[model samples]
Target: MRDTSTSEIENLIALMAKLPGLGPRSARRAVLHLIRKRALLLTPLADSITEVAATARECLNCGNIGTNDICPICEDNERANGELCVVEDVSDLWAMERAGVFKGRYHVLGGTLSALDAVGPDDLRIPRLLDRVPAEAVTEVILALNATIDGQTTAHYIADQLSGQVRLTSLAQGVPIGGELDYLDEGTISAALRARKEI
Candidate 1:
């Protein structure tokens, strides 16, 4: 980052370092690799980034990132199956889609209710979700928030708000597939037992 490195290269490294999971050392290595493969990787990557920067926008309905006001999932009328899946973020929604399950529509809450962060229901898309329920004639709501403390608190708050309005359900939490009992934590073991089903 001194006499050997140009300011532009240093700047690129700095920007890359700011990305999640990429520290300064990793960013430096990545930048060096990109420079070596400029024609093959850097130019194409830069072009794609520029295109996405100009067109990427959040879906107004579900907070999913897309190039339009309404994301493709929200625009799909066939997805309206009287079932709504509530998730904490766009990443969670994408993860669900990657699994190729859950054919119903989705509602992203943006974030969880957190006392420490002072994030309230209004701060997220909670009100939007509330409006979507009656407006969309939703019969069942599936809470797919993470299992963190704040996530559970947010889920409970949503459940209370929508109580008696529709059939409410939550994603079952427990030990993961192929997990060993010795490696499993106490809470995970307890949840797995509680959520056990008949064979």
Candidate 2:
């Protein structure tokens, strides 16, 4: 292997390995692939990354990441459906978008409140969420938090804060569509049963 201190490609591989869900081996393979496909992939990917690095900024309204201060979703007038989905992170918001079912706006809390990590309401975008409720004319605030202890705690706190203000709801927990019942955890099974709807 070439000395990393002297290799520009090695430096790129090192930085790539630091990204989430990537390791040294995967980074090495990816870097090799990019180098081999420089015209088709590498140059374009590099240009795109540089562009995003220069222009990406958080949406002032709902905390969604976009090049503009207000993201395209927030700028759309047709999406003003009085339904607001509150999520923990931009990734979760993106996941919801990929599903293509929801037609309303979203609020990204940035992160959940965690006692172990010393995160509080002030640390997250809780206050901003409250401010958005009235400003956006939100009729429903759906807490689509992860099914973790910290996630649940944050949900309960937000529920309390917005109890009487607007209709409060949460994302339904259940088994995945193709998941085997026998392989499901007890908590998941219980939630699935409770969330059952009439056919």
Candidate 3:
């Protein structure tokens, strides 16, 4: 490693550089900025990161990230609308929530089925989803997975498994091919959710 005057600050920058979308250059700049605003930004940010690292956990029922075993949406009785929207990741679930179109519950799959990655239905929360369907008294299952090949494959697998049990639907045309839900705007997500078609 390169020698630095402040090894602790250098270590912090090195760690930050490993975060998604942030490179070494950006991490250095961020570290300098944080140093400049130590009182207003750095201290609070460090505290927040520590708090989250200590408390962050996946919801046992739906896989949503929160501080509790069950997520807020899963715990809320008002969200038990007999509908479940399945997404490939937590970010997609958050995006859907941002849209505020579906007042129902959500199930995060963690990732899509990928033969290349050796991921299968059992690898995901597919079995948990099935168990929750009857347990939660769900009437519909909306596949809000991405438009990628793996996403479609996973959707079909779920559809087949829950064939006659509940109404299966998917997001409408607004979601472009290969577009991840996290990148979509709130309006686009809302429109797609509103216009979801039976699959």
Question: Per-candidate TM vs. native?
Answer: 0.95, 0.94, 0.86
Give a tens-digit lDDT track for model 2, residues 1-199. Answer: 5575568988898999999999999999999999999999999999999999999999999999999999999999999899999999999999999999999999999999998899999999999999989988999999999999999999999999999999998987899989999999999999999989999
Which ten residues in a row are the worst by lDDT in model 3? 1-10
- TM accuracy, model 2: 0.94
Candidate 3 lDDT by residue in tens digits, 50-148: 999999999999999999999999999999999999999999999999988999999999999999999988999999999999999999999999977
Per-residue lDDT, model 1, residue 133, is 94
Index of the highest-TM-score prediction: 1
Give stretches of model 2 more than 4 Å off: 1-6
Q: Each model's C-alpha lDDT?
A: 0.94, 0.94, 0.94
lDDT of 3 at 14: 96
Global fold similarity of model 1 (TM-score): 0.95
| Candidate 3 runs further than 4 Å off | 1-5, 175-199
The local lDDT score (0 to 100) that residue 178 gets in candidate 2 is 98
